[model samples]
Target: MTSHHPAPRPARPVADLFSADGRLKAIPRKPARREALLAHLAATLFEDGRDYREPEVNEALLAVHEDFPALRRYLVIGGFLGRTKDGSTYRRQQQPGSPGGAIFAVA
Candidate 1:
């Protein structure tokens, strides 16, 4: 008997991906909204597995956050980024030149 693999499913449309209520049903987590936001920010801040400084990241999240403290805390606590001992801004936790390279999973 010949073996057969099913064809891959087509990607869903943007509108279809988000339900009528504008909720992401696929993301079944209590903090899905926060996760999504952090993911977006991480993507914007990083380039080729490396991290960026606070100003760059903050500019991206400026409109979304009214208070800088809260935004920074949220990202740090989520393990998306880390801060230095001194009074510096946020940086992505994963080091760029690491053996396994960079990685940011759902938190």
Candidate 2:
């Protein structure tokens, strides 16, 4: 006798995670989804090779979600954004094998 299993659901597109007004409904709990969200945020919200102050970062993040702090922390922790020792500045991490430190890609 053979056992049957259901096929897995396809992952939601990153754009679907956001609300109609463009705010992220919530930070994804799943690791892969979260990473994709962070990468999308990093690519769209930040420019390459430009350093940003804490408030600047907050301003940009706030445009997407009210919980900028959590978003900020996740960005840093996920290796998508880099912060200074004292957390005074942040910059988007470059994509691997990209010349002149280009913006990171999602996949």
Candidate 3:
């Protein structure tokens, strides 16, 4: 008798969204992939736990795309970056499933 298991989903590489110069090709449509892509972009462009001024954040994000405001909002909304109430500063937040947290194992 043969035992069968469903195939596992292939790992999606978010890097494909970037051009050769490292600019984002476009914002993803699917929420999950979009969050993942945003997280990756935040990690690449911003330093973890570092405080960045409003203009500094824009400068970094602008390197990826012309729509800096949307990208900044996505990064903040995705829980990748924490913004001050006055929006003067931004800092990278620890990702839920990242190195410091439990990834796939059961609780």
Please tell me which predicted candidate would have the highest lDDT against the true structure: 2
Report how far off residue 95 is in candidate 3 (Å).
Answer: 0.5
Residue pairs whose backbone atoms clash in candidate 1: none
lDDT of 3 at 73: 81
Query: After aligning candidate 1 to the native by TM-score, how far in Å is the CA of 6 from where it should be?
Result: 24
lDDT of 2 by residue, 8-78 (tens): 43557799899999999999887667777888999999999999999999999999999999899888867
Better of 1 and 3 by TM-score: 3
Task: Return the TM-score for each candidate structure.
Answer: 0.46, 0.77, 0.77
The whole-model lDDT of each prediction reads: 0.52, 0.82, 0.78
Q: Clashes in model 2: which pairs?
A: none
- Which model, 1 or 2, shows the larger lDDT? 2
Q: Write the per-residue lDDT of candidate 1 for residues 6-86, one digit (tens) a residue.
A: 433233333332456654334223354554555555555555445557776666555444455555666676666776666
Q: Which ten contiguous residues of candidate 1 have the minimum total lDDT?
A: 8-17
Q: Is candidate 1 or candidate 2 better by TM-score?
A: 2
What residue runs in model 3 are displaced by over 4 Å at the alpha carbon?
1-10, 97-107
